[model samples]
Target: MLAALRVGPRRRRRLRAAIGGISDKVLTDCLHRLLASGLIERHAHAGAPPRVDYALTGSGQSLIDGPMTALGRWAVEHGDELLEAQESSSAKGL
Candidate 1:
């Protein structure tokens, strides 16, 4: 979610599209959590239909730049090994 917000602010629909397979409830829950944590800001635009946009806060950006980047790198480096382990475990279970 933070990674997706890295680009810029996005509306709910855009976010849902970017993060495929996430249910509306899950996305709303996540957005509320992020809002509560001060990691993201919600903007309300006054219009006939109204508009809302979610953008990363400074803390959120820092998180993405630091820990998230490292985590992504770690996943890239160990993904194959992790997949193999999962497959092996599943084979054993069967």
Candidate 2:
């Protein structure tokens, strides 16, 4: 999501490349979800070959700058600990 914002308006193909490891169906679903939530705007230009672009709305930008930033900071602070806990649990088969 942040990557998309950093790049500004992007077509679906660019989004897919920026956000790797996701299936086409998954990316389509996510884009729809974001659109439904009003966090992103979709613009379609009429032409011989249709052009579509996606960009983050003001609300989405605020979310990325606020809660998301805090979440990222928290992850940076405790990610190692969380990974260790997950590894221990997996080793114990629980």
Candidate 3:
């Protein structure tokens, strides 16, 4: 989700499309959490209908460039091994 926002600010619909398959409840929860933590900022537009946009803060960018980058590298290196283990466990019915 943070990766999706790394590009720039996005509306709710755009976010949904960018990070597909997440439930509404989960998405809302995550957004609220990020907002509360000051990792992201939500802006509201003034109009007949309300509109909101979300963008990452400096802290969020740090998180993405630092730990998230490392985590992504780790995943790329070990994802196949993890998948094989999961398959093996399933085969053993465990």
**Each prediction's TM-score against the native?**
0.89, 0.86, 0.83
lDDT of 1 by residue, 1-74 (tens): 88889999999999999989999999999999999999999999999899999999999999999999999999
Residues 1-94 of candidate 2 have per-residue lDDT tens digits of: 5556655889989898888888999998999999999999999999989999999999888888899889989999999999999999999999
TM-score of 1: 0.89
What is candidate 2's CA lDDT for residue 85? Answer: 100
Q: Looking at candidate 2, what is the lDDT of residue 23?
A: 93
Evaluation by TM-score, superior candidate among 1 and 3: 1
Model 2, residue 56: C-alpha shift (Å): 0.2
- What TM-score does structure 2 among the candidates reach? 0.86
> Of the candidates shown, which would achieve the greatest lDDT relative to the real structure?
1
- Candidate 1 achieves a global lDDT of 0.96
* lDDT of predicted model 2: 0.88
Candidate 3, residues 1-94: lDDT per residue as tens digits? 8899999999998998999999889999999999999899999998979899999999999999999999999999999999999999999999
**Candidate 1, run of 10 with poorest lDDT:** 1-10
lDDT of each: 0.96, 0.88, 0.95
lDDT of 1 at 70: 98
Sort by TM-score, best first: what order? Answer: 1, 2, 3
